[model samples]
Target: MNNAQEARRILRAHRYGALSTLSKKFDGYPFGSITPYLTDHDGSLLILISTLAEHTKNIQNDPRVSLITHDQRDPHIQTQGRVTVVGDAQPEPEREKAGQRYLRYFPEAQTYFAMHDFSFYRIRPVAIRYIGGFGRIHWVNMNNYAVADAEAFVQQEDALLAEVNARSSNALCRLLQQRHGISAMEAHAVGIDCDGLDVYHAEQTWRLDFPETAGIESITESLAQLLTATP
Candidate 1:
């Protein structure tokens, strides 16, 4: 896959990142916090923050921020793929839409959503840094990194994933074992894009990228090929 596609896939695979902001209290020093993020179909980042949180305060003072997310594998972290997004964070004016997608990924946050103090913010990326592995690093322009046609599949994502997890459990397990050698007894599809499936296998997650990107219309055929491929 190209660097842009690889970076987008990595972002979709992991949900948490280290958010770095200019500290409001520390006199311009950088402050970092573990933050959970979800991507809008166009590649902007969505984060839920409480008014009382330090990161929220920092963002209010200065919109400039950066977030880095990496693969969560057990191997050496330095060698794993990672993506750093540099952007400005601002309150999402149309927050109901953000809430819908964020809640799907983090349902437990429903209580926080009900609270008045919490609100969603969208980060508009100005630049991106993607590192696939050693010697595979590059600065990707915004146009190259964002998926322009994501709208074609985002609305149907949840239902598509639900059907796969519910009726195609064995196919998922087979793909996981054949690709990663992890014979997971239980697995559920957590995310889906035109490119691949992200499966939550018990405590760990596995990303299964198709041989080629599949549009919404061809997803069924793409998945069927994997299920029937020689292991």
Candidate 2:
């Protein structure tokens, strides 16, 4: 895969990151905090933070921010794959719409989601730094990194998920077991993009990369091919 796609895959595989925002109280020094993020369909990030949070206060003063997420499963941190997003964080106007998708990945945040103080912010990346491993690093171009036809995928995601879960759930289970070597009683597709599919099973999310990048028009066929190939 290209550096951009590889970076996106790494981001999709992980959930939480260290968010650094300019501290408003500490004379603009960088303030770091752990935050959970959801990768939006368009490759931006979605983070739910309370108004009272230090990062949120800093963001209100200065939207500039950066977040770094690495492969937590790897014991060797320095050489493991990681992606750093340098971006601007802005309030997401569509609360309910964003909340629906965000909540699916973070159901435990239900209480925070309901509170008035909590709100969704979208971190639109200006540039991305991707480190694949030793001797593999690149500054991915935003033009090549962005997902095309992202809105189409988002609009159809709920319906597509329902259809797949209802009719092809067994295929998903088989795909998970055959590919990841994990057998589970049930499996469901939580998200799908040009790069691959995200499956939730056994109380954890697993990412399955497609053999080839599949556009919105061809995603269903691509998934079917993978499922058919998996025994």
Candidate 3:
């Protein structure tokens, strides 16, 4: 796939990133914070922050921000793939909807979501920097990195994962082995988007991309087909 698509793949596979905001307290300097984010279908990022948070305050003063996420599986940091999203953060009024989407990826944050101090901020990306590997880096345009029909699989994710783990776990493990050459004793489906599936196995997360983007019905069919084709 292209660099933009590859960057989105990396973002889809990972859950946390380093968020940098213009420091409101430090004379407009950049302040960095470790944050967990969820991507919307339109390529924006959703971050939950408390009113007391430093980054939150920073964003209020200056909406311009940047977030960077890289592959953790790779030991050689310089050679690993990573993406940087430069954007503007604004309050997302749809808290309930954003909470539903965020909690699915970070269920542990439920308590935080219930608190009145916490709020959801949506970061609309203006530009993206995607580094695929050593010497394979390029700046990807927002239009090229956009995810179409993110809701296609997101709405059905919970039920779909339950079914995959219950009935197709073995097949998924086999598919993992077939593609990555690593055998996982047990695999749990953590997330799925139009482009790929995220499988948690052996205490690590693995991404397996589809041959093509998949919709709700096609995703199930694709997994079944992979199971039979893997051998």
Candidate 4:
């Protein structure tokens, strides 16, 4: 529907990616790791990694890297949609704040989250390569592909997360039940990276993926209304 919607779609289609880093042991060899990434609203990936991991070591040595995310299920892999983000990889300083959103997406990493060695890394894209499924392959011009820093919602993350989980979540649940005739014991927010928030309701066993970057505040309200209206 919009840039944020399109960005959210691109991210949902491909969750895992190949994170290529310069090998510390080998001078010419590039190291690759399959990583489950969470995309931020502006398209940067929020990766959960540990200082003990090899990729972490590589990233520390050099923050520069190229990360590729795509669907491997396609019969013709090349025909499937793929996005390659080339950027600098570095540890996120706001671990305690962003960790909530990151951990929500990946609950299994809770143990690692507690460990001092584990941390969140953000891939700040310098450029991106987007290949639309089937023959629509073209590199989006930087002007259109990258959202400006001012336009990105990078401040007050902790507050935003808290508000969403509290005010938004409850309202969303009530709306779903009232308008959609949906009933559930609980609603769990499964993921909240950057571009959108993915929530799960106990009754439907289905996911509600809502785009937040476009207008996170407004989108949250719209989703609640949509949920309530659905039958």
TM-score, every prediction: 0.86, 0.95, 0.84, 0.72
- In model 1, the worst 10-residue window by lDDT is 198-207
Better of 1 and 4 by TM-score: 1
User: What is the model-wide C-alpha lDDT for candidate 4?
Assistant: 0.65
Model 2 C-alpha lDDT per residue in residues 51-147, reported as the tens digit of each score: 9999999999999999999977779999899999999999999999999998877778899999999999999999999999999989998888899
**Model 4: how far residue 41 lies from native, Å:** 2.7
Question: Could you give the candidate ranking by lDDT, starting with the highest?
Answer: 2, 1, 3, 4
TM-score comparison, 2 vs 3, better candidate: 2
Better candidate number, 1 or 2, judged by TM-score: 2
Q: How close is candidate 2 to the true structure, as a TM-score?
A: 0.95
Tens-digit lDDT track of model 3 for 1-231? 778888887787777899999998989998999999887656689999999999999999999999999866678889889999999999999999889767766778999999999999999989999988879989997677876666666677778778877887877788789887887778877766677777777655667777766666687877666557745
lDDT of 3 at 162: 81
Worst 10 residues of 2 by lDDT: 222-231
Which ranges in model 4 have alpha carbons more than 4 Å from their true place?
Answer: 1-8, 72-76, 147-187, 191-196, 201-213, 228-231
Where model 1 places Cα greater than 4 Å from the true spot, the runs are 203-205
**Distance from true location, Cα of 52 in model 1, Å:** 0.9
Pairs in clash, predicted candidate 2: none
RMSD of each: 2.4, 1.3, 2.7, 5.0
- Give all candidates' CA lDDT scores: 0.83, 0.89, 0.82, 0.65
